[model samples]
Target chain A: MTQVIVTVMPKQGVLDPQGQAVAGALGQLGFDGVGEVRIGKRIELSIAGDDPAGQARAMCEQLLANALIEDYTVEVGA
Target chain B: MSTTVAVLRFPGTLDHDSAVRAVEGLGATAVEAWHADAALPAGTDAVLLPGGFSYGDHLRCGAIASRAPIMGAVRRHAEAGGRVVGICNGFQVLCEAGLLPGALRRNSTLSFVCRQMELEVADDETPWTPGLETGAVISIPIKNNEGAWYGDAGTARVVLRYRDNLLGSTDAVAGVANAAGNVMGLMPHPEEACDALLGSTDGQIVLAGLIA
Candidate 1:
């Protein structure tokens, strides 16, 4: 069966306070060149075909990724 | 009146038993509501968003589960000041559902917190909290990875208060009542504690109050 996977991350222009906090702490620990950090999730699903990928993407866009807060990418997996 | 309670189950909930136990122990007829379903059975006086890794907490805690079909009903129920609640991850759902304000951020200490904590009910007005005094101390189990409650200063002040506890100085908010004064979302597990077998039997009173 074909599988579809969706990856979601905090959208650009969103406040990733947690990621920012981590970057700040890293700088305090003497690390350099770490400009940005963002958190995201990876989800894999087993579905039938490309049609389901569209369905799954719609689900991600409407429900999974808060477009105002997050971005998402959908891909097909083996 | 003898009331009806519904426990919402989505794609990724754990701890289903104890939640049902809490409802049954409280004397409410218990039923399970699926996330894919929209309408609640007629006469469900209260709804329980039991704790779990619901929808795997995608996008943020409770963010995903809040979009389930049942959540729309939850939001509407709460809008009418119906009794709806969340515990732990469920609390996160309540926030995401907009039944309440504020959000559950990652623990400030960056750790999963699990401990017996004292709770003082802020107000007795909410049906969910009638059994506890405005500042009564009740112990319940706490377990969550992202249970830190946060919001703006004004919002935080209004949303939560530190309560005086004989057990310790717990913030006035062991739990919170939404604006409508019916919906509640808290971080502790009254379900787990409803039986002496789990810990304190005091949880029964808390659950009982909701069905009251």
Candidate 2:
């Protein structure tokens, strides 16, 4: 059985104003080295059956995210 | 024919009553339901998730409120083919609940937009829009901080598009229906346009069409 985890968020070039606002605030905190920061969703799933990783990734693609504005990544179990 | 409907007014949700009157105006008995309340009052037939920022647009539009209690009942109702309409912010909530596909984000222009736009009646099979003639152009008010429609090119074509050879789209999607065709979410405010003084009462047809 392969467990999987996924993360979803907007693409960098698509313009994330909320993320930019946070980055601006961070600059005020004396964090000069931080170039950019974007916010996204981190989802973890615990699967007890076979090919859990595949199922999780499919979920991310089919419904868990919008591919145009957001990109997603899946992590398979060791 | 007495139909009871529940209009959900989540915190920050501003257009609950307009939805209520729209339903009542169509001859349905309507009432206001809270987000925290777990159970809907008896005799409730349909549920309308009205517009507004349920959690101050925090986390994401409709994100935090997706976990609201009455949503459970709404989910159950949808599973049984009960009618549900999400307008503007209400559309955001339905997407967050996984009742609809894709997500609404800030417009590509990155501005809080308030305007009247035309929507081609994409599908006429659904209960919420039986009054439309599948390709009819209807006018409604659309106002929101985040109302972008995003998804892949393929899903945009089949699932969202009204038809080929048409070009009035922000993302080729102003509204979307679930696979079951009972639940629908629209970024436009049909209620606002249901009165003659509002300039166009085209929305009343769709609202009244959902009578069941």
Top model number, DockQ: 1
Please report the TM-score between candidate 1 and the true structure. 0.73
lDDT of 2 by residue, A1-78 (tens): 455778888887766767877888899999999888888888877776777877887777655666646888988866
Give the CA lDDT, 0 to 100, for residue B145 in model 1: 74
Q: lDDT for every model? A: 0.72, 0.75
Please state the error at residue B204 of candidate 2 in Å: 1.1
Candidate 1 docking classification: incorrect
Instruction: Please provide, for model 2 over B4-68, each residue's C-alpha lDDT reduced to its tens digit, 9 standing for 90 to 100.
Output: 88899888988887888778777888888888988877777888888888889775688777778
Candidate 1 C-alpha error for residue B48, in Å? 0.8
Tell me the RMSD of model 1 versus the true structure: 6.0
* Residue-level error in angstroms, candidate 2, position B71: 0.4
Could you estimate the TM-score for every candidate?
0.73, 0.74
